[model samples]
Target: MSTISVREFSYNPSAVFARVEKGEAVQVTRHGNVIAILLPGSGPVARYADLVAQGKIRLKAATSADRARLPHYEVPADVSPLDLLLAEREEDDR
Candidate 1:
C-alpha cells in the first residue's frame, strides 16, 4: 500500500490509476487524514463469481415449470410498454 495526498492524486490521476492497474493499492489522504483507497477492480464477471461463491446470489436458469408458475398478462399489440408504465404511474399518483 502507498499513501499520496489528494492534491498529488488530482494532479496526475492517470499515473495513480496505472499503479492501481498494476495491482498496487493506494491510499489517498486529505489534510493528512485517509480519505479513499484505490485498489484494482476485479470487474463485473469476477464480482458475480465472488457473489455466487459467497452464496449471495443464485444463477439458476428458469425452467418451463418455473415459467408456468409466474402470473401471465396479455398485452395489446398496439400499446407501447412505456405508455402502459406511465399510465400505471399516473394511476399511482391519484
Candidate 2:
C-alpha cells in the first residue's frame, strides 16, 4: 500500500488513482488521523431484481421411484394373465 497525504490529491488525482489500479490501497488522512480510504471501485452491486429475468431455479433431476408403487399383474411361471383367464373361462364352460 502507498501513503499519500490529502494535500497531494489537489495537485494530481491521476497519480493517486494509478496506485489504486495497481492493487495498492491508499489511506487518505486528515490532521494525521486516518479519515477515509481511496481504493479501486468494486464490481457492480447485486440486487433482488436480477432474478426476475431468469427462469425457475431448480437443481434436481426426475426419478423413476413413482413407477415402482404401481400394482402389477401376477400369474404362474408357465401362464400369462390372458392364458390364465382363458383357462378359467374354458373350465367354466364345462
Candidate 3:
C-alpha cells in the first residue's frame, strides 16, 4: 500500500494508475485525510473479481432446484402479443 496526495494523483493519473497496474494498492488523500483507494484492475468487472477473491465481497449461490422453480416468460403460442394489446386498448376506450 502507498499513499498519494489527491493533487499528485490528479496531476499524474497515468503514473498513479501504472503503480496500481503492477498489483500495488494506492491510497489517495485530501488535506492529508485518506479519500480513496486505487486497486489493480482493467475495470469494475475485474475489480469485482479481485474483491471476491480477497473475500471483500461475498456472493450467494443459487441451487439447481431454485433456478428450476423460478418463473419464466411463457407467451401463448396461439395468440400474438399485438392482438392482446389491441384488445386491451379497445377495452380501455370503452
TM-score of each candidate structure, all chains considered together: 0.45, 0.40, 0.44
Model 2 / residue 72 / CA error / Å:
62
Best by lDDT: 1
Best-performing candidate as measured by TM-score: 1
The regions of model 2 sitting more than 4 angstroms off are: 42-94
> In model 3, what lDDT does residue 82 have?
79
The TM-score obtained by model 2 is 0.40
**What tens-digit string does per-residue lDDT give for candidate 2 at 2-92?**
4567887667889888866754456667778756555445421122123312423211221346336644667878878888778878999
Q: What TM-score does model 1 achieve against the real structure?
A: 0.45
lDDT, candidate 1, 11-67, per-residue tens: 999999997786555668999996876656764233455554465764444445865
Note the residue pairs that clash in candidate 2. none
lDDT agreement of model 2 with the native:
0.56
